[model samples]
Target: MFKDSVVIVTGGAQGIGKGIVHAYARQGAKVVIADLNEGLGQQLEQDLLAKGYSVLFVHTDVTKEEEIVHLMQRAVEQYGTIHILINNAGKFQHKSPYDVTFEEWSDLLHTNLTSTFFCAREAAKVMRHNAKGGAIVSLASTRAEMSEPDTEAYTATKGGIVALTHALARSLGPDQITVNCISPGWIETGDYAALRPIDHAQHLSGRVGVPEDIAQACLYLTNPQNNFVTGINITVDGGMTKKMIYEE
Candidate 1:
């Protein structure tokens, strides 16, 4: 459905970001893989290109304003305009509020929240000028609603993202642009599965989520027909948020 549409997926080299990139590419969208990991990004680009998919890898440090600005410029230079943006780049290190260092807390906030704002600002400028408008989907987490131990920084940043999404939606709606956030819960990525096998099974689905589950929600939000759905934080947590399971 995204044929010829230009889509940007930050952190598109692996995990959930990779899944989103593949989904958009399969639908014939021109994809830009923006991330800090140059090697992985280049490899993914080459692999997708070999499969006859239109993709580009731009080594971007989302926390840097100059790099984010350059990434947008490169996207426009390569594909003319961006029709969708997936703000999937984030950092999640476990640390208690009392134990977390100042630098660590700052890094998490900068990477997860501030960077999202920077990229959205730049993309909205271009999308407004294009007059066709665009869509933005940010990766949030269910921790924004329910928190676990040592997840203070992550939870705080994710909550900020939900608020940011709503505010942006209100401001950008006048320009015909839509902005939303997707909150994933207990996803079974390789590292996460290895880290918390038991907690992963506590979900109402009796299993953890996968990258594709979140990607599917992203596709729906960014779809051309879903223009009316904006400023909402859709939770893809397998109903975990609905249950009141207490851990003793």
Candidate 2:
């Protein structure tokens, strides 16, 4: 569905980001992998290229504005125009409010919240002018609404992203650009074989979430046919968020 389209995926080297990149590439999109991990990013770039897919690895630290600008410029330079942007570069560290220092708090905000704004701003500038406009999808978390212990910083950033999604969507709608957020719950990016039966039973879908779940959501939100569905947050969490969990 994304043939000949340029799609930029920030933090597209590993985990959920990697899954998004794979999804886009498989759909014939020119995938740009913007990430800090040179090894993983380059490897992914080469792997996809070997498989006859078009992909680029641009080393980018999303927390830095200049690097983000460079990444966007490189994307346009390489692909003519960017059609979709996936702001998925974020770090999640479990730390209590009292345990987190000022520096740590700032780092989390810049990584998760500020980076999203910067990337979206740069991408929207290009999208607004394109004949097809564009779409932006940010990776948020279920923690934005509910929280576990020692997750203040991560939760706060996610909540900020949720709020930012609608704001950007409303502002970008005039340009035919769609902005949306996906909040995934209990996504097991690690080895699934390590998980026990009860772990899967805890979820309403009878299994923990996977990165492909969010990847599909991104595709739907960015699809031109789904143009009317904007400024929304789709939670792909196996219905766990709706189920009541009472301590026994």
Candidate 3:
């Protein structure tokens, strides 16, 4: 469905973002991976190229506006236009609210929340000129609506992403650009083999989610036929949020 399409994914070096990069590339999209991790990003670029996939890795710190501009510029220079953008770069913090300094809070906000807005803005500039418009999907989390201790900063950024998705959808709707977010839960990016059966049982789907699950959601949201479903947040959490637990 994405033949020859130009797709740019921020933080597309590892974890869930890596899954997204592979998904788009497999569908024939010219994928541009924007990430700060040079090692992972460059390695991924080489690996995908080995499979004959078209991809470029741009070392970027999403929290910096200048780097984002450069990332977009580089993509447009190479691909001529951008058809899809996936904002997936973010930081996680777990400091207690009391101990969280202004610097820490501000840094997290810039990394997680501010970067999303700027990336969308820059991408939308190139997208607006497309004949059929474009699509943007961001990585949000279930923590946006629910939270645990020492999650204030992360939760706030996620909630902001949810809100930002709808707003961007409205603002860019005139140009036919669609915006959306996916909220994932318990996506075991590490050591899936180490998880006990009880961990899998916690989810209503009878298993934990993998990066591929969210990658599938991204494909659905950015599909050319599914533009009607914009400005919404899709929670890909294996129905964990729906489960009501009680003390045994």
Residue lDDT tens for model 2, 1-248: 79989999999999999999999999999999999999999999999999999999999999999999999999999999899999999999897778899999999999999999999999999999999799999999999999889999999999999999999999999999999999999888999889999999988899988889989999999998998999999999999899987899
Clashes counted in candidate 3 amount to 0
Clashing residue pairs in candidate 2 (N, C-alpha, C atoms within 3 angstroms): none
TM-scores of all candidate predictions against the true structure: 0.94, 0.99, 0.98
What Cα-based lDDT does every candidate model obtain?
0.92, 0.95, 0.95
lDDT of 3 by residue, 174-202 (tens): 99999999999999888899999999988
What lDDT tens digits, residue by residue, belong to model 1 across residues 1-248?
A: 89999999998998899999999999999999999999999999999999999999999999899999999999999999989999999999897678899999999999999999999999998888766699999999989988879998899999999999999999999988999999998676686536565676677786788888998999999997999999999999988899976689
Measured with C-alpha atoms, the lDDT of residue 207 in candidate 2 is: 93
Candidate 2 RMSD to the correct structure: 0.7
Could you give the candidate ranking by TM-score, starting with the highest? 2, 3, 1
Model 2 error, position 153 (Å): 0.7
